[model samples]
Target: MNFDERRPIDILETIGEIIEAAREENNLLKLEESIDILSTLIDNARFNQREIGILNYFLANVWSYIQRIKFPDEEFPLETPELEKQIIHLRIANRLLKDTNDNFKKCQIQTNLGNLFSHIGRFSEAQEYFNQCLEIDQNFEMAIGNRGFGLYYYARVVFDATQQFIFMQYARKDLLNAIASNQVYNEAKYAFAGMVKQIESAYPLKELNDFKKYKDFYKKLDKKEINYKKWSAENKLFINPLNDILTESVVAHDYLFIPTMILKSDDKLFFHSMFNQLKQEFVSVRFLFYESVNSPKPHFSDKEVVLMDTLDYSDYSFTLEKIKIAFRVCYSIFDKISYFINIYLNLGLDKNRVSFRTVWYNNLDKNKGLNTKLLTTKNWAMRGLFWLSKDLHEKEFDTTIDPDAKEIATIRNFIEHKSFKIINSFNETWTKKTETFEIDRQLFYDKTFKLLKLSRSALMYLSFLVYDEERKKSIEQSNELTIPVNFLKIKDADKI
Candidate 1:
């Protein structure tokens, strides 16, 4: 029967009739007809908001079911383009829920979006959406589990030769989160066990230790009366030194030994280069940590520790010295400039009403101006600046940048001298009131970090430039001194 001929009650009855007919036929053609009838009813404008939402949900389900039947394999076609149609359908469903302020509706859309993304191998994005769904309704156990599973699956896809270590770390986090939020103990247990198996298969050497840890976790959950058997059946235990050591070290700042062999005389240089590359890598990692703070995930404490330890053994002492020296020089310049600006120009010395103009004008009054105390205070300021610079520089350098001893020393001097002038210029142009500065503390912090990060980048680039120049000159003069690309590896020490 046509939708126009039906009353509101009749429409409801018609929907039920369509559903029953579709189910009774159990045929694709009849199912399609039922869906068409529902669509026509939905378009009639007679349905209220609730009915529209329900009808849309039903339509989504029908589409999902059809897709499932057409492509039974979750990993069908392998090519992303083949999934474009499915993604489009999912997107349509998601858009329909945009105005759905109800938490349940939001959860439904997010869950479906997550599922669609996961199917297409976009696990990270899928995990994010699934987590959103869970946040709206923590009791939505399926979404919670899917979020974790998505992370695990995504980790698997990216767990190739280049970044296997990173993948394993992420995998561990996803699996752990999945189990924690799991409602059914069997589900959690089984997922956890499966992860343990994957870990073992991927990394065999440290299997005993890894298995022991998983066994301990499993036993704890089992003691709590969680489904131990299901978990045991699903997951096999295994381990690797990298994962075990890294995880332990990160979670607790404990040291761990990572074995290596020096195959060539140039191994040290390679290690040094790798060390330098890690500065940017660690920064990126830190940024990721910041971005992923909202997610139900674990911290990369082990990865951080591994990176830090690796740096420590890779000429960390020299790196710190270089950074400290550079910082001291930069601070000296800043101190001198700040002193002139504050005491001579009277820029920042007011206890009551402070501003650049007032400070400058006050400094013009010789009676209220420059004194031993003022100069001494400038030195103290210099020391503070020096400390801040040194701390940040050391952190960045030790974690990321590795330079040759001579080159590092040169860059340190260059930055100390050059950056001081830059800071002086920037400060000289300071027109805002001191009160304003205090009011916007976050702005100041952000600006400070930005300047420091920029200065660090410049210093790194200049160091490389100097090295390149030296290499070119040497080449022209004679081939006696062959500088390696990575300063650290110029020695016969070790490979990264």
Candidate 2:
């Protein structure tokens, strides 16, 4: 009947009437008919910027609802192709309005683009568009939720074992962000929970120690203990307690103590001096003590007590030796914070910590630090850094040394001032990382001390190369005597 040729107002009126009729009839088929009528109106109408934007919004809502219905096998129906066609039509309608400089229209178009890409299994592309929508309007809950779903799908496509862990990390982050921003997004929340369950199921560690950490996490979440007796578990990733301890020690030293040491010390020499005092204090402490009767001889004699007392050991004598050792190691590593700051200032390294502290303090003052504010910001940064360094050999580098200095200052300020808000904020940041990132004491140690050791070793080798060029030449000569210094030798030497 050439209804599409009708006037714009007439087409809108016709569309409204059809949609109303479909609603009144309560028929799925009629709803489809109404969609078809609206599609035709949108295709033909010479809509203004505002009108096209509104229509695109309407179309987006309709498409989202339609996509929710699927075949018995949980696949989209054959009618989905028609929906995709309508999405393209909607995009065209919005693009025509782009010259009007309408942000709302652009956002709608991007959102629709994200939806279509997601439907077609182009999850990465969908994520791009969804991110564009968020950039236009961060508070757009729908866009946020949709981006979360896009990430979930992208995670599913990841194949590499190591990369799958990282994919799940981003997927979980996006889903959690969606839920945090919009609590009503049940679909996104469900997807996030389901994905976490899948990861835990696939990588179930068999050793009691490895499982204990997850067990503890689940216990804190009030999750029921898994009944291991029921399933025939295979392939356990062994837990190395020493490795765990070293990892956590490194993290804590790098992030916690080092920062504090830097903040407190005036210079490197001062820091090292104080560090030596602390180290001696820690090392001299005889944690194992024994009581002696008046008649019996004392364990080391009064002479030994006087000798040890003359040193820095007497004060910390009652503490556990391991605790003292850890404290000393923490203190020692912390003393290097000044080194990091000096290097950063001289080398023009990106001071992520400076901005991080500024933002953290601002949020703390506003009482917003704990409620997904700092965690989200830090997570974003971590994800970015993780991806940036994924292929690099510097994964174990001490990144927190400079940042931890500021953190220590902030923590000290909060402690001295008795500011509950600051305390709560700091605690929140720590707890959130612990919970989501699987950061334990051992992980912290590794990041701080173990990384420091590795970094120092590398630095020592680099220094040796710089200082002893002759030694390097001699080694190269020795190597050439055994094997020619060709491409393979060069490659091997470069590795060293």
Candidate 3:
């Protein structure tokens, strides 16, 4: 019973039960003690990945319960440190569970991750996780129901009418499926049915676009086209979850426009062209990254590979360089998005000074938080971008979602302006004594892939922010002018 005096394994055995009892008896003191004991065990004791994952999952659940107790309101998304703590632990648990074969635990962790993401207004990521849960076990009622429930709430916040209506239809379908599954809890089933009814009443079936065709084309085909499903367990380092995130983000970006507004100009074409170019750059980077991962060996015949007259043969190869290039390009895309933001918002901030990391802050005083003009826009996508920017900022502005944000920035800085080494393995001696930044090659790849995902998300948010503003402008200027703009499709041969 004295957990403080028990061995790590012994403590792990009893900790879950102790926490459950604490929750059952409403014993906050006991719960707090258990949390401390588990944290100590995790940090001090030797354990396998699975054990660590188990401990983290329990800790995350405890935090979740504690936060729910502290904040009983169900209307607004939670942004508390406690909630963030839960998310952090759950993410760790998910990563640790990746190689494990425990479908039940994977389902639980992924479902909770989805739930937490939804709780924090990151509905797209949440939906992706929920979809991942379904991929693991098709009959997972929690994920099934949560997806429907989350989609309903997500639809409420979406600004675009067509997208909103499409999401409502999807939500209705999932809710109905959840109800039919017969495994969902009664309360959840009631909620699902209620959402379905609301969707039906708000957007009638006849008024909506063909949901089947839309779903099949957009949702189903995306994963296949991304080719991430082919990434195997053997290639764990190459299997980035951000691949899914980026894929889903493209869906969001494309969904921003619905072809109803009749006003256009050369400026619109220029902006659209710029957006297209940025997207192309990102796509090329992602392709190179994947190709580097898939490459069996460096090809001597390839013109790109042969042109390297001065090559470092010290554990260096073209594949590695490709990865580094991808990382550099992906990181640069963030600044480009920031540049777009600067021009679009017309903040008149110095062109050189504006950056993704600094654009959201006040020109004079970043300590004042988000910029005044940004705050006034009240665009959800813009607000999301502001928060996303915090993840890349200094510790004082961190969002707690990415603990490695500072390290990532440091890596990017080192890559750009200083010495950065991506070794196959960690060299403690060199890493500790040398001024050069060194990271395990796998870790470097992971970070780069993450940067790519972040860039993709930023691009999506930028597009949606423009859509939100444009929608508002159309409403405000309804009586002002009517400009007929014609659309012409570019041929596939001239697309580039």
Candidate 4:
């Protein structure tokens, strides 16, 4: 390893070899001595870009590994001053390698930086680094695990509720990708599973996208495709699993309700009719709103859609029309859920007999507390079980649910109060954030999808809650002789 006659590459390999052997033998003093010599060589030499990059990267890698091994049993908060030393080395390495198109070096530096930034809670910068590393190679495990790690923290700090879940969605999505790609970090699985367990214990009725999460993960893994794209799943692309939203509507109905002697034939028809209406709304959403952004068949040309508008007020009506229909579609999915449950509970024969309904019907048609039930039917769980999401299950529900509720709450207010905030997030770290009544196309697309997911989750939970109570009362009655078996067959069809 003589510096006088040897080439720079050979000198670096010699230094790296000594450091590796020292590390392998558990000789901490020798490892530090090797790093010191390598560091001195780097500081004293003036080499070509490739040589300098290699040397700097080696120094950074050695320092970073040494910090982890410094206290083998210690937890990796990555907060020690030694880790900060690693950050400096990696930054120098990244700068030296910037001119060269060496992805391995780029990924190595960026991943270390992401880890340090995440520990410091600078999530925006951390996300940037992790994403950059993944761009070099999606299968890069450090980037994958650290990217998910950054997202989890970002979700914690974000102020907007709807925006928080969007972060978590990406968080869970990528973390699962990291897990499925390879087993580089056994601890990543443990950390992720712990987070999920906490989420469940905190929220009683919380469902992770109906617990059919990240099916896209398997699709990507199956193909062995590095060029795989995300943000394009049929369910994830737009709001409302556009490909199979219809199936979900019926599935929600069957899973939430149980047929009993109290359920009349007309009540069954009423519930079915509500779902049919929901199918229509979801169809309109796909055809009118989602299709416009998803394809824009009429406007696309030369691989981009250029909007050239010369008319002054003409654009106004069309924009308003889009808003009206999109809102209507999203609202219908939500509004009908209340109607469906209300119909089943209030339209039945035993409504007058029950002391409490334990739910509220949102529609004006049958919300009169079932036959005006003469004496008193207590508003047991508030006006509606989910009024302000005040129920026990809602109280224990995950933070994810509230964001959806927050977004949908604003929508409800828009109709009832005639004014609501439509927040348009300009870009990452919010270079421009505004609460304008005017619709930003991309913002609406994102918010609408979140609202759709929330609506589905809430309805499913509500139906389960209401029917669960009904089943309890029915059990007390022991009315097995009068129970309907037809609906029981469909009950297991959508159990989460």
- Pick the lDDT winner: 3
Task: Give lDDT per model, in order.
Answer: 0.42, 0.39, 0.69, 0.50
lDDT of 4 by residue, 262-319 (tens): 4433434455445545644654554455444444343323335345653321122343
lDDT of 3 by residue, 1-496 (tens): 4556766667677888888988887766777787887787677556678888989999997886676566667533323567767877887888888889988999999998887766654655677789889989998987888887887876765665665776777777778888988678899888888877788888767864364332322455566444542332112222222233233323322333222344533335555666777877876776787787778776675546434432322246778788889988887878788888887777777888778767877773466666777756656667667656656745345454666777887887887889877777566777884568888877877888777666766666666677677677666745644565454545659967
Is 1 or 3 the stronger prediction by TM-score?
3
Give the TM-score (vs. native) of candidate 3. 0.75
lDDT accuracy of residue 437 in candidate 3: 85
Give the TM-score of each candidate: 0.36, 0.34, 0.75, 0.39
Task: Provide backbone clash counts, one per model.
Answer: 12, 23, 0, 3
| Candidates sorted on lDDT, descending | 3, 4, 1, 2
lDDT of 4 at 229: 20
Quality of model 4 by C-alpha lDDT: 0.50
The alpha-carbon RMSD values of the candidates against the true structure, listed in the order shown, are 23.3, 22.4, 6.1, 17.9
Any runs in candidate 2 off by more than 4 Å, and if so which? 1-26, 43-46, 56-74, 77-80, 97-109, 196-496
Better of 1 and 4 by lDDT: 4
Runs in model 3 lying further than 4 Å from the true structure: 7-38, 46-48, 75-79, 153-169, 202-274, 300-314, 342-351, 363-366, 370-378, 393-399, 422-443, 477-492
lDDT of 4 at 234: 31
